[model samples]
Target: MKKVLATTMATLLFGLSFPVNTFALPDNDVSANSQVLEKVSLPNGGDSSQSEAGADNKAKEDTIAKKIEGKLEAKDITVWQNDTVNWKDGVKLKEDNAEFKNYLEEASVTDLDNRNTNNSNTDTNDDRAFKGKLKITFKDKSVIEIADQKLYVTSKMTNINNSKAPKNAVDVKLQLGEGVKDSNGTIGQKDNPVEYGSYRIKPGVNILNEEHPQIKNSLFNLVKLQVSDPEKYVDPQWSSGSANKKDFVVSKDNNIFTATASKLFTMTFKFVGYDRDSRKSIEFDKLPQAIKDKLPQEQKIKEGEAFEPNKFEDTIKENSGEIKYEWKFKDWNPTKSVSVSENKNFEGIWTRSKIEENPNPEVKPGPGKEEDKKERPEKENKPKDNSKAEDKKEIPEKENKPKDNSKAEDKKEKPQEENKPKDNSRVEDNKNNKKSNNTFPRIKSNENKSSSNKVYTRTSTKETKKESKTENLSKTPKYTLTINSGEYEVLINGQVIKRQMDVKPLIKNDRLMLPLRSLAEMIGAKVEWDPQTRTAIFTNKGLVAKIQIDGNEIVLSNGKVIKMDSKPLNINGRILLPISNVANVFGLTNGNTKDGIDQNIEWDGDNKTVEINLNK
Candidate 1:
């Protein structure tokens, strides 16, 4: 106890001699002691202010050492050295060849410079150099910086003119070399240059004089040439008299086109009908054979020339009965031009002028025409009465003769009136039938016969009207719902839906997800949302389906629950349900091919389109 008390008293004296911070502390407490130790001198005779200056210098060096991102995109090309090579058969890149892809990786980089200053925060008084680099990347994401790396490609020209230079451009031989970049990083050096594919000067193309055909089009002017021995190799030179003597220039990476002017190309102009609502084009080849035969024979286009498609401009009328389309030329795809050096195709676009149901159809008899048919017999009787009155005037004495003679004349009229089968109402109302009506028993019999005939006519008319109504209902066109994947617009019955959808139709879990409202409205179904439950209800033709957001089961009005391929997604506040689930709930089924029936739903995988055909 005495020794412990002495030790405690000695510790207190040592703590009091030095301040509270004079005692050594754990590393975690360094921040708490930082302020108090800021001015403390180092054991090596260094001040805290000097140590902070060194820290600032180290931070600045780290800032300047950051990397800058830079990349370059270029086209790859091939040059031919053989004079016998054909230019008409233009060269195509063999993407399958591994060696051809390597050329893209071996592209040269030169004249590296860093233009970014944001990485470094050097003060105006500081004198440090920026060390950023220009990074050139390739298709494979491989990077190479500008350095002292060089790659070489060599070729030899054949058939040099020892005696004199050939006046014709076709007689000149060529060599193939690689495009190089100069020290300034500019490409297209003519010394040890790459050759353009071989071609004989076209029949009418002129390559001489200041306004040469090749120079007029800059594409052909960049061809490189060198005059050397047929079978011997010569070193490429960059002097005025050497291979660099040509005045033409090339692109950084020469992009050879698909076709050259050496071969004849065919140009055809097509006048096609474009329906904007359906997004369908009716080409000339799709027209009926009978209509095609009736129109003027299609004009044959000459090769290496452009022509107009005006032959079919006024010949095609929209009376074909297949589709109610009145077409008028709207515009052209590639406008017509006079230049005919290469293959040029022009399409004369035609669009539907108006939506017409039936401009001219067969006219059926109306109510007024039926009245006219009934009144025809009365009109005929009027002319006959006038003739009888004339006969009375010729024989005035016979006017007072017996009624029996007149009855005989009236009996002759009965046969003529009965010949008019459809004039029953007019025949019953004849003014000269008093004698027949006065006989009570005969008149009663006639009345009953006339009433029976009237009833028969009315019954036949009602039956005919009912049949016509049923036929018209059957003739109504089917409803078509067309939905293109990744498209916001939906088409119904060849007409675009006026309402726009918030989100495009998409595919998830190998099932197509369609908007609930659009899909329901397309098939004549009503959609209702229950916000409290986050559920959507679709009702159509006594069928109801209840779908909840993020739920994989669909409940139907028939008390059946269906397991769906995917859950309904709530995207952008709009519910999207799988099409297969909706289809099953709506009782849609594929048609039997053996019965020549069209399917209710069609899925086109290639075009990513879904078509639902519904019967009314």
Candidate 2:
């Protein structure tokens, strides 16, 4: 049968100490009729019958006195017995019955007092009921106090046939039972229970099993021996007779129990490319094997929980390589030290095609290998005498023909020159002459001039000219500009020029022409348009550049002039200047161009893009 083992063991283990009154009671008063019981006799039989009857009567009275001893040991209690009396001498007994009754009452009260005094002495030397508070403390800083708790100790009979079974086969354990409750209610029950594995019974025995030897002993002896002789027949070996008899009592020095609860948190890692595409994510379990191997076993944080911030170091390092399948982020790179905060997500940005290198470039034949091969035989086998005569004859003929052709060509070029305005053509011719002589021509501005009668003169000075040329070279700044044809966009030093222009930059006559004002501003220069003169002037840091509408010549602050093959044009009300010319005049080229300037510019014909890296 299932039974709840009482908390008797708990009381023993806890050793609840209860305060009992130790003061002694005064002696009871001896009655004047105390000799009456000695004279009383049995009504029937001989002397043997009367003696047996008195012995039986005395034994019954002693049992009654012992039962009420704990209750009436004090001095001022009244005792009264009212039962039909049996007497052999009816006349004599009736007269002396009052004395006998008083005597019996006095003896019974005195006997109870004596018994209590003796029992108190024995209890002082033996173990008594434990009465105190049972305290249960939890790991969560919770405490429970049970007041007036009792600890019962008892033993069971096992190995029935063995004579020593009562002593050796007894199992002693403690039980707190339903009596143990905290402020929240019962501790080890369905509604309110201790944390799993937190509660424990003493002697390491399962208290829930009713048949457990100790539990059986406690239950049977304490519950079954109700009418039996507890002192002699109860489980004396396990009963709480003395301190030594109790097995499950908690040690007075350390009476606390301990236990733990579970906690949990989350972390996420995300990988993204430069353009925000090629995205991937990893959770604790979804992490790559390489990353998982390097990570601490305990690094797997629970979802929605908190963890140490540095736990992902090794894992990030192991997976760093995987982030760059063939590309990386230009601005941000993932590192081993990258960490995700508790409950936070981390993302790494990478890029593709940011840096590229051609592995095997094609090697082309140098200069004129084929031409040299074809001309080598001609050099060895030509007729020397005939070749000399032919050279002499052809030389004079070629010279005389060019002279006649020059006269005709000069006449033919005269009309073209004459067709242009006189002042402009004369200035152009002077500019050309200065260019041929490797000198920059300066314009002598007319101090006395009429708007309609504009005149121009050329001036040159050795010292002033040299200073002007040097000033142009020194004041210009270096920068890079990338422009795409058919797209009205420009990148200056990797930064896009924000202004929008009506016309896009394009390639014309092998020269790039872009919006004059935008290009000027992009290079930290200012542009002013003069409608009257149809001229656009660009100036930066005291250096000035002037380009007239449909004019092929550019004028600088030092009056140094640069001639462009393509003249400036006004498109959509915006002057478009030849970029190659402007770059040259400003000394912005890297000297790689074919004619007017070095070809510091790279032309991607396929994409129609012009890239200029100017190093001034």
Candidates in order: C-alpha RMSD to true structure: 27.0, 34.1
lDDT of 1 by residue, 221-255 (tens): 33332323312222222221224343222221222
Off by over 4 Å in 2: 1-485, 488-500, 590-600, 614-616
Backbone clash total for model 2 is 22
Least accurate stretch of 10 residues (summed lDDT) in model 2? 112-121
How close to the true structure is residue 462 of candidate 1, measured as C-alpha lDDT?
30
Instruction: Please report the candidate that would top TM-score against the real structure.
Output: 1
Model 1's TM-score against the true structure: 0.26
lDDT tens per residue, model 2, 1-616: 0011123322343555333222222235764234232332323533434565778787765553332322221111111112121211111112334544343333311121111111111111123432333332223323323344322222221222322221223232222221132223323332332432212123323233446553345432333212122221212121221243333333332222211111122344554433212223224354335433433222344322223333221212222432432343222111121122234443443333211133222223565545544453344344753464345445544677766656556544653675434433343343345334323322222211211121111112212434344334223322333454244333321223222344677667867787765566435566676656878788776888888866699888896888897877666545677776776666555333234443445455555455443322
Best by lDDT: 1
Model 1 residue 37 CA deviation (Å) reads: 68
In candidate 2, position 294 carries an lDDT of 38
TM-scores, all candidates, are 0.26, 0.21
